[model samples]
Target: MLVKLGPLDAGRVADLRPYLDLVPDPRARRGRWYSLTAVLLICACAAVWGARSLDELAEWAERAPDTLLTAVGVRRHPLRWRRAPSRTTIGRVLGAVDGDALDREVGAYLADLHDASARAVSGQRRVIAVDGKALRGSARLTAARRHLCAVTHHRAVTLAQAEVGAKTNETAHFQPLLEPLDLDGALVTFDALHSVQANVAWLVETKKAHYISVIKANQPTAHRQLAALPWRDIAVQHTTASTGHDRRESRSIKTCGTADELGGIAFPYACLAIRVHRRRRQSVRRESRETV
Candidate 1:
């Protein structure tokens, strides 16, 4: 027989309980065997168990009494219990739960996990990939849509998440989500959509984080200015390599004798840019290049 444990056994679920206990609810009325702590545990466990609706949670509470009791750390023998929390009870508790506080706890857990994992690696820094995900059906109002902005450190799970209101643009909320994270000695990476100069500046200056943001047409002026400059003529030298059959190889190099004209990009103070390019070609017994 497979013995079952509770959501506390889950890695993410274990991280949430301690903080959930600290949340205060004044109008909470406890049942004979159930307490506020148990209620939160139920909710957290339900969330971990993929309980998206209140009826599902209530049904779990009724049918999985043993599992629920064990999860709540109940010592007494299971009673012939009925009248598990109604769906209304579940909804009320959810409404009372502090979303911001829960978000902070989840963020803290991720930060701790990141720190622990980083200690095992060789580098002195970490890389955080910034991305956004829309919660399906989370947008309740016809006019507002809910989106979650998340940061995931490379080679690890999610590091932090924040829910934005329907009307708030995600780019405007990106900084605040980034503000509490430990970005020192870290490299933050984002896509062209988040390549705002102000955002990049904040990552470097405010968070002390290095950034690598892709440039695209949204910033037409910046793109034009970058392309117009003579980067190929600068002292900044880059090497690219190509390989083929019979141990054949080719490499191209470039240099700017002076630093003034390369890219002509106005980076924030104390910031620098390096451009790299590479090409590779290989075949079993021979190699060929088709050039126009």
Candidate 2:
């Protein structure tokens, strides 16, 4: 696994250098003998093995001292010199590391991993999904629930994120997050709460990213007017209907007209309206058994 990571990648490990550059022993510092790089490597290796807290890493340092040294590019297997630094030291180093810098380095490394996977496959599918999720454990800080707005590309890899003070502030964070992302050719999806005129216009005008957003009661007037439009009136059309053998049925409708007309449609009216109709028919077999 360590070999798979390509340890020599300069860009990826640049953030790790600050701690690594420190001389572990002042007396041997001039000779470049002892360094914090070993310590940093040991802690990282321990964490990779599922060591959560620093205390666990300290225990690993004592047990696998030699294996840990070589894993981190410490030059050679070590003869345990005075015990490894306490858990507090490891935690402090990790805490003191600039989070932004670490995040950038980590993201870049992960990107490389994904890039390798992309190359291994003949054709690559890159999909970026943008959504807002509340920090599950964060206590409500105010009357409005604060949401963590994150733009994740390829699922769990978070490209960027911001804290939305409230529903109204979503647009503000959206702009900043989109500004830095390379969204061209990516299908971006969001919920009804973000289906604002300015937001759509921005996605079209600024990022060149395609968007598909849900429409809901939040835009009441628009929703009502859209519902009233004749589906045949549209140029491009989409329709879906489904039936299942046992207690399942579904209906879907979609249509797209000229961007000009879509733009002209008044807010709370139909630029685009999607209705999901569902009906579940109880199986006759189940009914017969119940009756008997």
Candidate 3:
């Protein structure tokens, strides 16, 4: 039978209970030995503390003190024999549950966190960066690699992530990840892979959010047109330089109000066009330059 972990105070383990509650139990009630919430909560806490695999998570739970298990909502067995679910139970429950639903629930929880943080800071605009990465250990065993689209803040707090199927790319999962997020007045940033016109329009018109996407050869015409602009004549320019790890890097950014030459294209609320040029040099004679 399903059970709820009632209101918990603001903390790491407590914050996860609401999201874990959304995961439907796939087990039959007649022979069930553990609640889904308790299993998930214990697993989440274990993962956060550096447990990478099911075996490791189970070991962590087994070694956990009774007080820690109780604090994380793990109930004592009716017979008072076990303080938490076994490793096999954790693996079975995780494998049987709906992965997509779990992802959505986690996203919703992070969105709530972002909203609360925004409120506490007096409406400060948050920066959400979208990127994709592949799981390191999953690639060797299967031809279909596991990739995930992660939305993170500038402060390095990961808000959410969505899985990108083997047949599809990050672009396919990009909008879906942002769909569940409340991005109003927030600035969303993405790499060149997501610099499509439709995405720009949707972010501005539908989501009512601002964006700063890198321009690249993916969109040939837009890249060429943006490159042809007379950036040297722009008045608003910012330049900075830094040196670290035997390398020196410098960047210059130029911004302009609007581009008359590209008037035909409908860029939603198109008020600014920016160009960035970067150069880097290492002590060993390696050098590179990039423009965006």
Model 3 stretches astray by more than 4 angstroms: 1-10, 78-82, 259-266, 284-286
Cα displacement (angstroms), candidate 1, residue 42, comes to 2.7
Ten-residue segment with the worst summed lDDT in candidate 1?
A: 1-10
Rank order by TM-score, top first? Answer: 3, 1, 2
Give the per-residue lDDT of model 3 (tens digit) for 126-197: 889998877666676547667878887855656678778767788877777788788888999999898778
lDDT of 2: 0.57
Show how many residue pairs clash in every candidate, following the order shown. 4, 3, 0
Q: For model 3, what is the error of residue 249's alpha carbon versus the real structure, in angstroms, after optimal superposition?
A: 0.5
Give candidate 1's TM-score: 0.65
- Which of the predicted structures, 1 or 3, would earn the higher TM-score when compared with the native? 3
Tens-place lDDT per residue, model 2, 1-292, is 2223433333434545553444232223354443456556666566666676678988877776543454455554376444455676566666655544444444444544554565687776555667888866566555555577876655366656667774466766777766756566556777776888787778866777677666667767666655666655644344444555655444444554423455444552224445444444466543211100
Worst lDDT 10-window in candidate 2: 283-292
- Candidate rank order under lDDT: 3, 1, 2
In model 3, the worst 10-residue window by lDDT is: 1-10
